[model samples]
Target: MENDTICAISTPIGTGGISIVRMSGSNALAIAFKIFSSKNVSQESIKPRYFYLGNIHTADVNEKCMMVYFKAPYSYTGEDLVEFQCHGGVLVTQKVLQSLIESGARIAQGGEFTKRAFVNGKLSLDEAEGVIDVINAESESELKASYGLLKGNLHKEVEKLQNIITDILSEINVTFDFPENDDEEVTSADVLEKLTRAQKTLDHIIKTSTTGLKLKTGTKVVIVGKPNVGKSSVMNAMLGTDRAIVTSIQGTTRDVLEETYIYKGVKFNLIDTAGLHDSNDLVESIGINKAKEILKNADIVLFVVDGSQELDNFDKDIIKLLNDKKVIVVVNKCDLKQKINSSILPHAEHMECSALENKGITEIKDKIYNMVIDEKVLSQNVIITNIRHAEALSKSNEIILRVITDLQAGANLELVSLNLQSAWETLGLITGVSGTEEIIANIFSKFCVGK
Candidate 1:
């Protein structure tokens, strides 16, 4: 099955300047030469790693295109590969792919090329996942983290830890063979010291996931306030566009409005819900219910309040709903004579902003970034952005901790070795050294078709 040639439209399926149909495997070059023809190039004379101007012949159409060949062991899949850059159109690209299939190439599955790269040892599982992350990144921060993984930073760290574990296992084996020799025996203190060092490394890596997750999935910022308090205005200012309708009428926004914006390389998913106020209208009441629901799950709540008005029951009710939440008190319309007192909400950070004038918006953005992300994590070369890697590392850490506990308890050497080996194997899963086929399949399945 691995020897079969595979092909797909690598570029997005749409009208563009060019569309690329990619192929890989032992027969990629042979299959490409079967359909491509040019005045100066032939199947027998085509050079590797060079593009040839040609025409791709299909059953229904013939189109001028550029054909490139990559020899095995040098291509993305680490196999013989070819790409046809044809005129960008849905029908043209499909016809090109169809021609390849008809010429004995199979359609590549989602992420098949990258999967082949993984199988061929060109990239580790996490690095392959990082390729997908780069493709799907929504913010600069996400891209930076993904690029770090793609460049093998995490792989190097994991490899280091695995090496330490392998050494410890070897030591344990020696201790097991010469139980009577005090010089060869692996003491509990030695194992503890080594495992403790590994544990510290794991702990720092795990800590980066907090910021990684936020980068992968933007921080959910829910804006809530009483009617006509400029919640929509604040949202517009943050997004630099009018995403929600702004009106003087109370309850104008009866449904949740959501938008995304990037600030300082971080993505913020802003959700503007109906004003939190007493209402008899059925639709408005339903919107209020949804607002409450979204508030409970929000990463940060922008509790917008009209600075021109004193604190009211509506504001008090909304504040109560924010119990124990990471709240940012947004005193909107600060350009007006201040009436709302800031001392009332001491639990949350207060930012005075005039949304109408776009005043203090940058300060609010800075505050949100500081409140959620640690600056140090962003500067680190390796961060765990994928939840799978984080979970695997967490499991490995747990096993190592248990091994440490067992060693401290004076457990048998064999028992400690068993736990240590388990930890080593668990770490291998992140790099695909010991991962199951099902796990590998699931991870690649998340990738876009033709990746």
Candidate 2:
């Protein structure tokens, strides 16, 4: 299957300025030349990486297009690659893909191109994941983290740690083969010191997962408050669009409203739930219950309160619900005469805002971002954004810790070598060096076709 020519519509299948149909394999250029006709270019004369204007000759339709080729060993998949930039439209792209398929190019599966790259040693497993992350990134922070992976930041660090292990393993092997030589025998102290360093490196990388995950998956910011407290308005003000209904009448929003916005390169998922209060209406009551449920799972709760009105039983009731949650007490309606005391919500960070006038919204965004994401952690170039990488790193760390324990307990060097080798292979999984076919298939299955 890896030897066959593969093709797919690389660009999104919809109307746009242009859409690219990509192909890679030994027959990529042959398949492209079979269907594409250019005035001055032939398969023998077409230069690699140079674009040529041409007409796509299919059975029923002919369309003007542009074509480019990448020679083998220099292309994205390290094989002969070709791309046809056709007029952007649903039918046009599909027809182009079909034309290629009819011309002996097999349809590329989801992430097949990238999978080929990984198989050809063009990318590490983590770097291939980074390519997908870059494609699906929702915010600047996500893009930065994914780009770091594409640039081989995490791979470099992992390689360094693996090198340390390799050195120790080599010494252990020599010690076993030549017990008579004292210099070749690796001492427990020497192994412990090197393993401890590797452990610290792994620990630091694992710690970044907390903030790294938030960057990849936006922070969940749920808005909860008494009715008509500008909860919906605050959501609108933050989003710069009126996504939720806002009315002077209480209980206007009877269900949860959700929207997402990017602030300072970080994505924030704003969920405006039904106001927290006692209600007789069955639907509103259900929504209130759901709001309470969502509150428990929120990354940060924006407890909105109408500053124009004094703290009432409804406000107090909601405040008590935010027991140990990471919360920001949003005293909305600050333009009106202040009546609600911020000091009442002692458990949360307090900020005043006038959603109607769009005042203090920036401060709210900054505070939320600062509260959740640590700038210091993000400053570190390598972060594990993918959960799989984190899991593998954690397992490798555990194995290394066990090896340390065995050494400390005066276990045999041969047994210690076995654990060390296991740790090395576990780390290799992150780079695809020791990953099974099933794991690799599952990882690529999450990718969209044409990736």
Candidate 3:
């Protein structure tokens, strides 16, 4: 992927005011000159880092374009780069790109530009991931977290911790040089204290993955219960929009209705499932089966119970079925007064609401927010939100724990040294310093073309 010069339409292919055709590699400027006619600009005559008003002539008509050049080491890929901002008719962009390809620039693979940025040392693996997050971000909180990562907060934190570990390793090495004299003062107590502090830092950062991932990808929450418990209404109330239909008739919703909404900078995938119950009707039974299947993957379940009706065997059976799920029992229609037994029902996270009245909805949102996010993590300056980074951290933690154990057991210094080095190597995987070629390819492949 790295050996070839790459070109692609950097802007969306559509009818607009402008579309950008981007090229990068050692031959970028040469390719730009091949199909472009600009005053005093030749492949060798063009000055680096200059923008020239130009015309991109295909086999037929010419379109006015703005071209910019970046020489090696100063360009996005640390090689040469060129861009043509042309009038954005899908036809015009396609013709211009086709001409450039004919002039010898290869089509860029997905994320090839950003992949080049990663290879050039302008960005780390975390920053590259952040770029994707920023592109995919749907809420203010997700954008903020991803923006922080793009600014290198996560990388800086990990690098700082790595430096500290390196220092500790140096101290351990020093202990071997002075066996009886200087080494004796650097006692087990001192070593244990440093290890304990490092462990605390690692543990705290590891726990942030829970809330961070939720913020990044959004939580999958399913609203489910027996018919007429107002599942759709509750969903509409929470979303503050008429996304799902509300009806007085039983089995009004026969399939899943999904809507996405943002709250407190976090995205929520709100799924309203058909009311669950045994039924003779084939369509309702299919819906019921789908509801059951969705629950298996939901991060949270809002199990609605009718407060206006007496507790029945069907309701009890639904509650029993959801006993192991992360359920927030919602007692709906509080305006009618409570008839359902609050005591005999199994205690879980509970909320009261009248979806029709919009009462207690704010409290429900707050409770849901608190149930999922850790306040301490949100306040912290850094977090690990990527599964790959999280996996590397987990491996690094295990190796660190092994090092600590070896130290405490009075194992040979060589054994302890080996474990500590292994921990350091594991940490390197997060930044791609020691990662495999296959892993790099996999990560970059997630990016969109011309990114």
Top candidate, metric TM-score: 1
TM-score of each: 0.97, 0.94, 0.94
Off by over 4 Å in 1: 180-182
Candidates in order: C-alpha RMSD to true structure: 1.4, 1.9, 2.2
**Poorly placed runs, candidate 3 (over 4 Å):** 40-45, 171-190, 341-344
lDDT of 2 at 315: 89
Candidate 2 local lDDT, 269-341, one digit each (tens): 9999998888999999999999998899899999998898888899889988998899999999999999876
| Candidate 2: segments with Cα more than 4 A from true spot | none
Give me the overall lDDT of model 1. Answer: 0.91
Better of 1 and 3 by lDDT: 1
Instruction: Please list all clashing residue pairs in model 3, or write none if there are none.
Output: 141-265
- What root-mean-square deviation over C-alphas does model 1 reach? 1.4
